[model samples]
Every structure is written in structure tokens, then in C-alpha cells.
Target: MPTPSKISVVTERGQVSIPAQLRKELSLEKGQQLLWEKTGEHEIRVTVLPERKPRGAMAMLGFAKRFRQTRRTEDWMAELREGEK
Candidate 1:
């Protein structure tokens, strides 16, 4: 497997610098398209794809179902509050 890229955040703005090695590996260029999504409270997912669509709808739906199935009502309330912030 290829090694994951090391990335750094920009201090002045809420931007991140993707490592050169990873860019080259992914064939990313200055104007290449990318998608950014907040995967968790402390982590953001950045993916380079021509179309900014999730890989599979079924997987996403299944994940949502599993999440709802696992969470308590209080947990759902806490998540809603977190999103408001």
C-alpha cells in the first residue's frame, strides 16, 4: 500500500496544504477538483475525484441506518446540538 500523505494547516486561514508527494501520487494539480467533508469533530476528509459523489449510495444509506440504530435519543440530541455550533 502507498503511504498516506502528511498535511499541514494554514495558520492565517482555515486552509490546509496537501503534501507534494501525495499530490504527485494522486495526479493532483493546482486546479484539480477535490471534495471536503467533515468526517468527525476533529477530522475532515479530502478526496480528489472528478465528480464529487460518494462511492456508493447503499453504503452511505447503510451507514446512516447503522448510526441511527446504534444511537440513543440523547445521543442524537447531542449531535444536533453539536451541528448547531
Candidate 2:
């Protein structure tokens, strides 16, 4: 695919604004996180980092509700090996 480029101006505090076209193409929203790296002397790479979210107490419950403790680890392994034979 052909890549599009746009000129950006860096602010006084070493900040650069991503253009609207690039933002729209990247589906960037307000308060999103970005990872930037200086790859070489004159080149930099940008990666989209996952958004940080605080998990509430309710969000932590019941994911593995069916989990149960086995009596022994060796028994579990034996059971798995039995199926292979």
C-alpha cells in the first residue's frame, strides 16, 4: 500500500502533533497512548501501545469459576499420558 506523509510542527517542549489524516487512519482517540523510539540518528519509529485501564474489583471475579484443585500434579500428568497411549 502507498504511504501518505504530512508535515508536522514540533512545539517548544519537544512535542509533535500527528496530522488529522494520520490520526484518522490510525483511529487515534483522545488520551490514547503512543510509544516512540529513536531508531537511528535521524529516524524515529512510533508504535501504538495498549491503552491503560484500571480494573475494578467486580471486573476481577468469576473468570475461572469452574477451576478446581486436583489432589496431585503427578496424577494429572499420568491421566494426560494415558490418553496419548
| The best candidate in terms of lDDT | 2
Q: Report the error of model 2 at residue 33, Å.
A: 0.3
Our model 2 lands, by Cα RMSD against the true structure, at: 12.7
lDDT of 1 by residue, 1-85 (tens): 9776575867787767878888777888777788889999898788886845557764475565655566688999999999999
Which pairs clash in the backbone of model 2?
none
Off by over 4 Å in 1: 51-85
Question: Candidate 2 lDDT, tens digit per residue, 1-85?
Answer: 6557888888999989998878888899998989999999988899988877557975668756668664698898999999999
Best by TM-score: 2
After superposing candidate 2, which stretches have Cα over 4 Å from the reference? 56-85
| Model 2 TM | 0.59
